[model samples]
Target: MEASKVIHAIYNDDDVLMHAVKKVKAAKHHIEEIYTPFPVHGLDKAMGLAPTRLAICAFMYGCVGLTVAILMMNFIMIEDWPQDIGGKPSFSYLENMPAFVPIMFELTVFFAAHLMVITFYLRSKMWPFKKAENPDPRTTDDHFLMEIPVHGNQQELHDLLAQTGAVEINVVDKAH
Candidate 1:
């Protein structure tokens, strides 16, 4: 198979890059990817990307954390060793649930946050010791990069990107 050609359009400003994305989508071109120096509001919607389901995963993780908290508190306070917590020897998990409320809340937040981070990293194919996939290093600091696949109309695409105020344009063979 032949190597695929791509155009990397660099933008100095996020507003210009956003406008360019709209124009490119209006022209029915497929944008492969975009890299921005910072998070741009509404960029995902502009790119027509599906909403992420990470929130659902977070909710599930929170539920697991809550369950674990309940079971752990029950085992430690009621089953394994019943203690006189807060001058009340309520040897019942349900009776002492009010005291454990803070613990449950903390554990739920902790699990949701940590699990979401791990899930995001795994989903993005990022792992410890993995090389970066950024096409240009400037995108991490002061530039935005838009990657568009070349489909035998490089000149037209270049013209369009130039019209959209791209600071620089590069044609590269994308390595898989």
Candidate 2:
């Protein structure tokens, strides 16, 4: 059971929103979340959020995909089947490599793209087969939302949010 103060603001311009957020931060209030219809360039820095690690994950997943492609192809073509169907040289890694390339490439691309997407989705809390927990339906459209958790001193918090130019304010109690 906890309580949080939330502010909802509608801004057509990202610059205005950035200015408001910077003011709120300068007043030392904790921002729980910010919702927008589109990405705002400087919003992350303004909100004090750490940079995303998705690129590192993508690189690792791509390496894994390459490894999987190589291993599966090598195991099937060399050890398991050892086929000489085209009258090519026997046990030739180089000659048969060209033929297996399409499948290998397909597997590599499939694994890399799919895994990387999944990783990003999961990291961003957008994983498949999971329900979306959108706080408001209107946030998906024209409105921009800024939610702040009131860390201390309720009156001070309210005054600060007011000074930051919040269009609408709400205090929600999660405890039943």
- Number of clashing pairs per prediction, in order: 0, 0
How well is each residue in 29-139 modelled by candidate 2, as lDDT tens digits?
777788888888989999999988877776777778778887887888787888777687549567688887787778767877898888777777885588766566767
RMSD in order of candidates = 1.1, 2.9
Best by lDDT: 1
- On a 0 to 1 TM-score scale, where does candidate 2 land against the true structure? 0.78
Q: What is the RMSD, in Å, between candidate 1 and the native fold over all Cα?
A: 1.1
lDDT of candidate model 1 versus the reference: 0.95
Worst 10 residues of 1 by lDDT: 85-94
Local distance difference test values of all predictions, in order: 0.95, 0.73
Model 1 misplacement above 4 A: none
Give the C-alpha miss distance for residue 84 in model 2, angstroms.
3.5
